[model samples]
Target: MKSKIGIIIGREFNERVRKKSFIITTLLTPLLMLGLLVAPMLLSTYSGDEQKKIAVVDDSNIIGAHLQSTDEINFIETELPIEIARKEHLEEFAILHIGKDIMSNPSDIRLYTNSTASITMEMNIATQVKMVIENIKLQQQDIENLPAIIASIQTEVNMQSFANDTSEDSGDKANSSIVATVIAYLLSFILYMFILLYGSMVMQSVIEEKNSRVLEVMVSSVRPMEMMMGKILGVASVALLQIAIWLVIILGAGYFIIPELIPDEVAMAVAMLQQGASPETLNTDTDMSLLQAIATLTDVGYLAKIVVSLVVFMTGGFLLYAALFAAVGSAVDTPQDAQQLQTPITIPIILSLFVMLSVINDPGSDLAFWFSMIPLTSPIVMMARIPYDIPTWEILVSLGILVATFIATAWAAGKIYRTGILMHGSKPSFKELWKWLRFK
Candidate 1:
């Protein structure tokens, strides 16, 4: 049985991975992942490089004095009429027309452009007009303290976790929470994608074999259990290979690309860490600098733990879900038939992603506790809480349940796969599947 399974695994792994699509996907997936996230950030940052010149035809005369230029836009007050400004071609992007009594009707302010006005263009003009009007209203009401009141409002509150363990520094706790939340989010997302992608692949692999009646010939030589296990294991290897490459890319980007791209943000985060330094070590404020704080946050130890946890959950989740997907493929004659069976399998995966925000905010909550431990959701949910310091017992319990679930599901799926892989005609309903499972 072992030898047969090994041969099947090798053949399946070799045959599928050598395909043109598989090779191209493996090579391009890292590039695609980086592009999806980093492209928008980079593009948006440089989007406002060129300053747009907007001519202001302020009939009210009040707005022209207060309308100041910004990095992305330059405002110049003009005495020329609106009709003449349209034809003058002053190299301006747009013309803002402020009405004489805009104090009465704010909507009278209009932006006219040679081309259609963009959202940014409209917003810039509107903001200038609104700010002038607001300042006038505040003066009229004699509310000179408005600026001071606004400045005094605290927008961000520092959250400190008060667990039994207070030996950890507040700065360390804050940094860890940030790191844990980020790791949890990435892990949950990766697990969701890995499980769905590989699980569907397993189903499609089974469907292809069944549809061609190739399983009929294969069954005579290899036991159904061996064939099923071989297919799952073979596909698992493919998944691991893809993920290993992705992990290297992710770690590389974290170490190299991130700092070069967003230096200011990196500097600010490091500054924050320095500000929140440990209370006991308050004597050496001059010595602790931004570089040291940045180094602390990017600790090599924490990153390794996150990477290992991610690899484990991603593989385990794929294996657990792939069994059901394989069973669906064996029972169904067509991809459409498999869709009905996929809903039940996919719900828990989706639920895990949806509820992860709550878990990240409060990993010790009861809701997070049960969801992370339950076998169906554990594959994604447990990893989400692991970085936030999940209990040792809970991790053990979740792993035990997940492993057991995979074994039982695989055994059950094998029974259905053996009976249905060659039996194709009418679609199998839920009742028919129940009968197949009971077969000796």
Candidate 2:
């Protein structure tokens, strides 16, 4: 039986790889997805390079000097009228007016623009204004070492964790949480997509075979159980191969392209080792400690455990759904008939995705825990929660139940497959399917 399953898996893997659609989609899909992810950053970079011209009417010289030197800002030191500033091409000038009311209150700096200013421009103005106020305050108080005093003020609070016998740094804990959440989301989405894509493929294959009367000849030679197992194994092998190839490509690209493409600050953070800098001196702001950041990415053992659990759940989930799809195909004579039966399978997937999305923000919540424990939803929900630090016992229990559910579902689906594949013309109702399950 194992050998037969192996043969079926091997054949399915080979056939899928040879298909033009699979080959094209496997390569292009990742690239398209990567483009979407990076598009905003690319646009931001392009916009950052463009010069922003601002006309300043400085009645009081307090803010003009401080705001003049910001990057990509061409400060035009002009006393131009507001009308002239507005009439000038919008790309060429924005006006900043300092009112006479600033002698008593230095905070009265007004900006006039035709439309709402960009976030970058607003931030730059706010920062400059803040520095001016701080300097004025220092002068008023007659404090000479204000710069040193300000530098010594600690803006970031140091955090330490004491849980689960793990000595992870605060950064490591955060990274672990992030990586776990990302991995969970990725696994859930992948399972959802693969189940829909390949499960449909299985159904289509069954319908084609039945329509052409090929299933009649094929079933005479092999038991329905063997054939169903073979088909499932074959399709699953193809999915695994495609996934493996995509992983290799994505990893390779991330390794090589990321270093060259990412901002220097982020690159530096990713490259730094945790031990290289003292925990006190480490900058929490930049990606200067990427090596440390990645090192701190959850416990390696925990990550491995979650990954393995995801594979088990995803495989079992796919098999369970694909078996139902196969049975649906067997019962139907055409693709149109299969569509009506697909709602039962598709609804669960849609619900799982919806529930997983909601639970991700609050993985430890009661709703998340209960949904993840239920067999029909567990495969996706449990994966979504794994990144938030799930217990080993919960994983084990989920797997135990998932495996049992798969066995029961496969047995039930095989009975339906065996009975319906041979019968034609009259479509089976829910009652008919229950009767078919009792067939000897």
Candidate 3:
């Protein structure tokens, strides 16, 4: 019996793996994901290379001297009326008009642009003007170097967090909430995608075979139970293979390529973070938040735990859903017919995704814990909680429940599959499905 199932599994596996679609998708998906991550950074860097020149008509003459130039924008002072500046300096991006009474009537200041202005550009100009107005107000009071006093007292707070689960010595190393949140979001999403995509693949495959009458020939020799298990396992092997390939690509880039690609300032910032340095101690030019995130992701032990948890949950989740999908496939003659039956199965999966969003915010919440305990939702909800370094006992209980649920679900689905695989012509109603479950 096992040999027969193995043969069927081999046939199904080879058939799909040999397809051009499989090979193309396996190779291109990583590149597409990479593009999504890199595109924003590239656009931010080069999209505004040309500096926007603003013709400043400082009627008060107080604002222009304080106005500064950034790489993306320049403030050019022009000795002309606001109207003249707008008309004559058509080549400039905008005309900034400042009223003489601007100290009291701040609304008198305006910007006339040749075209629509971006929020960022408008905010920049408004900020500069607002600062000048404040300084003027301060000078009117005749205080002793008030501007320098304010600048000297400027301060920002950076709070370092450590997990209570760590040892006393390990408490010195701060944990990043941002890293945990990002990892949780990504893992949950990946688990959701894997379950939905692979589970549907099993359904579609069953539908195609049943419609083509290929299953009629194959099931004559192999038992329906064996065929069902064989098909589920076959497709599962393919999914695992694709995931392994993706992991290799991702880990290789994270460990070997990405570190080399990051700027030296980023590395220095990460090093400072490890040594318990405050945000103020790191180079102001470096993006400390991004560097800290990268450093946490590249941790060998942490990454390994996340990957293992994902694979375990992914396998259990897919199998549990895939069996139900196969049963739905066997009952229906077409994809349209399967839709009504699949709704109940799909709702839990969809609900889990929505719940995952909330889980990232509070992994220890009662809602997260209960949802993670429920087998139908645990795969996604638990993966989200895993990155937060939740208790190991909770994970073990979730995994045990998931395994038991999969076994029970597969057995129940097997009964439906064996009966539904042979029945045809008419769609089965709830009553008819109940009868099939009771069949000897």
Q: Please report the candidate that would top TM-score against the real structure.
A: 3
Clashing pairs in 1: none
Clashing residue pairs, candidate 3? none
- The clash count for each model shown is 0, 11, 0
In candidate 2, what are the lDDT values of residues 1-440, reduced to their tens digit? 33465666676678778989999999998898789888989987897787777777776766666665555677776666556755663665467777566646766777777566788787787677677767776778977787788889847554432125355543333344455556778878887888889889999988887889887987877788888888987887787777777767876676677567666665454445333344445555644234333644423455566557756877877888888899999999989988878889889888989999988888878888888887778888888887666676887787788778888999999999999889899777878988999989
Cα deviation at 420, candidate 3, in Å, is 1.2
What lDDT is reached at residue 43 by model 3? 91
How well is each residue in 1-440 modelled by candidate 1, as lDDT tens digits?
34599998898889878889988888798888778887999987898687788888989988787988988878888899888977784578888888889998988888878667678767766887788898888778876687887678847433443224456554353334555676788788888888999899999989999988889999989998898889998999888887787778777877796577546745555545446544344333332333343444466655677778777777778888888888999998889988887889999989988878788888888989899888889878888988776556888788888888899999999898888897888888888988999999
From the highest lDDT down, the ranking of the candidates is 3, 1, 2
Write the candidate numbers in order of decreasing TM-score: 3, 1, 2
lDDT of model 3 at position 210: 87
Instruction: Give the total clashing residue pairs for model 3.
Output: 0
Cα RMSD (angstroms) for every candidate in the order listed: 4.8, 5.0, 3.0
Error of 3 at 210 (Å): 0.9
What is the model-wide C-alpha lDDT for candidate 3? 0.86
Q: Give lDDT tens digits, candidate 3, residues 1-440.
A: 44588898898899989999999989898999999999999998897798899988988878788888988789899998877777799999988898898878999888889988999989988988898888878888998978789899998555556567645453354557799998899889988998999899999998888889888898888888888999999998888888888999889877788779878778777766666566666765655556667666766667899889988999999999999999999888999999999999999999999999999999999999999999999999999999887888999999999999999988888898888888888888867877887889
- Misplaced by over 4 Å in model 3 are 166-173, 261-291
At residue 427, candidate 2 shows an lDDT of: 76
